[model samples]
Target: MSDLKLTRRQSLVLGAGALFALGTRGAFSQDATTLTFWSVRLNTPELQAALLPILAQFEAEHPGIKVVNEPVSGNLVYPKFLTAVQGQLMPDVAEAYSYHPLQFAALGQMAEMDDLIKSWETSGRLKDVVNEFAYKKFFWNDHYWGVPYNLDPRAIYYRKDLLEAKGIKPPTNWDEFQAAAIALNDPANGVYGLSFPAGNFHITQHFFMGFMFQAGGSILDKDGNLVFGTTARDANIRALTYLTDFATKHKVTPEGIGSWDTPDAHTFFQQGRAAFGMGTGVLIGEIQRGNPDLIDKIGILETLQGPAAKLTAGFFNPMFVWNYSPAKEAAMTFVDWFTQPGRLEPLYAANPGGLWPIFKSEFDSELTRSQPLMQEMLAKVIPYTTDFAYPGTGVPEMGVIDGEKMFAAPVNEVVIGQKTPAQAIDDAQAKMAALWEE
Candidate 1:
């Protein structure tokens, strides 16, 4: 992982065509000095409500600098940022994804942050507490590409009251999970033992990758070769077979659950028809805002462990400095100021619905630990969580999505005796292999 090697398959994921579109018009001089920050978050009234306070704090710290925040909502990111860069109107600092770091870093739209990190270390202001693999996700080839300000991790949400009423315990591993799913699954009683996004990749893929690796298969090995057909593949086949089967074969979950995306699944959980849901910590807050009773009934846990290891993606609102920013140092200064514990922890803790802190110190403090729901769940999670660099770009996301669609749809086929698990995996792998090869 440290070598930061890209698999042959991963290379296609960050396709150059997308990288080519990055804005590179460098019209602003380093000292002309306007820190235009670009992020889709600050644009929304919803996000700005949360962001404006931080903006006020940032301004208070730096008097000469003026901050211009631009948020580009869904579907307009490409054109919005592209036009700014093409017109020589680039953000002095921009919010970028961990997955997209390689693309932007390669595009020269973002700077190499090695020197900045070194300075942070010398000054004792840097806290790269994430695992080495995770840290390296932003560092590719030979440079540090992004400063991680926030991170996302997947967690398992279950109804504690229901489980306790039924005399069942939360699952600690896969076998226990399947058993719980079977026990809790009593549709006539109006409770589905377990639930997942049946058809959608955005809803299910992150959770599935954690399962796939735990099941002992992976999209590619460290050397970057596609390793699709193996026992781990069969494990994945069974794993999803269980997922889709809850709806199609077992009738535990409603049929066609796969088609729903994240919001849809959240709705399902909010309505209380499902016993459990897998999502980030934010989903819990959304539920509680409307129904506080739901909070007392729910418990959080890390996604259950699989055989290979506990593989999963960490969600991050990552920050990056434009390689060509008129004020690189100033942008980094903003970044450093933003991440310092004194500044960020209070803000994060205040938004209990958003993600938890990246710093373990903040995460372990009495302030965080005393809060029960997710804080307690972090106990079950902290030991097992692994941040697989999110499957970045078309090549990886596409392949995973295709594989998920191909595999999950037919899972019902196998459970109903239409195909064996091996056969299902073979069919799915073959389809995925073809797509990956493209």
Candidate 2:
């Protein structure tokens, strides 16, 4: 056997070649139905243990169908799947970001799940399972090209003890948030008010979007035109100014905040170096595991309200069937079954907080009610959650703009004081507008 190497955005496993091999053999075996599934997060022993049994159950129910499950790294899954599409070796079902399926749908490479979902016995309950914003995120062009699988929403994680001691309340709005941050800063005490990720490519964009949305600004308008420079320019500047000021002006954040990413902020919070951090539910798990003492001290809140709205920037992972797959029906069958409340419960159990349920019923279930953090998230954050791509008006190019740091560069300039918020927003607007042309 020759060692096969696959490379594009990132060098993922050569294991994809094994899928190709199995695919070639399955082509010859006409009696059996083989469905190839490319997914991520199953590389761990824990995830594998949880997922393998589900695959077995699916195969047991449908004896003729064989699922060839392959795990890809998170960073490489999208690029590798793109490579598969280009090579005409796309999997029957693949895990993708909310934007990935949209991009693939635009290319006519993804199978629409609207009919399958409509026909499924549980389809009527989908809206109850998946939230409205998520439904809108996955539904585009009058069809659903993907099924909502996992949701991750941003929230403000604060130190309860720090706030109580300072006589500060959890901030409900932007003004209060800034005041609280400033009040909690104690440099000599070796504690900062907030730890933000201004240096991270994706996190910076997310933070900007959250603030922008709160300020009644959107990246794209109803007409699907870029609004950052025209109608939303001032709001964008306001958002940028507010975020950059935490580090540059107010100095409430750590001195190195300009270089911190999600993990860095997580570390800062876990070590009790910061009073507040912005992140998803993963922070709760990190606190539980690394700083057990702070479990009760830590409290989660919805993102701060801007002048125009209260919103939280979020991301969702979806699974989609390929238009080219020979096992489309079988693949859809598996997806339908996999999304069932019973089947999804174990998966959520395997990675609590890290993967939130997309279904409303799941949120109301005993399983979800047991996790107070998730319950609070369901009540407080998920209602206002919006994706970075700008739900309803998201364009495939926006993904490229986000991935290439087109938006992050200008935000970075503002954070470093190299440019004014107005100037940085102008630069980002110009850059993003140019992306549409390309």
Best by lDDT: 2
Taken over the whole model, the C-alpha lDDT of each candidate is: 0.60, 0.73
List residue ranges in candidate 2 displaced over 4 A. Answer: 1-28, 41-43, 120-122
Please report how far candidate 2 places residue 289 from its true position, in Å: 2.4
Q: How well is each residue in 1-438 modelled by candidate 1, as lDDT tens digits?
A: 012344444444433222223343323444444577777533556566677678778887787556667776745754565456445566777774444455545445568878766776787545545444445456555677776666566777888887898888888787787777778877786667766664535446566656766766655555334455553466677555555555655566655564666677777776776777776666756765777778788888556777656655555456777776657777888877877655565445555645555655556666565557757546766445554433321123333333234545444455345676567677767766753553
lDDT of 1 at 166: 84
TM-score of every candidate: 0.80, 0.89
Mark the 10 consecutive residues where model 1 has the least summed lDDT.
390-399
- The global Cα lDDT (0 to 1) of model 1 is 0.60
lDDT for each residue of candidate 2 in 290-404, tens digit (9 for 90 to 100):
6677777877876678998888677777788887676777888888877776676676676667677776666776756776666777787887887765634455555566666
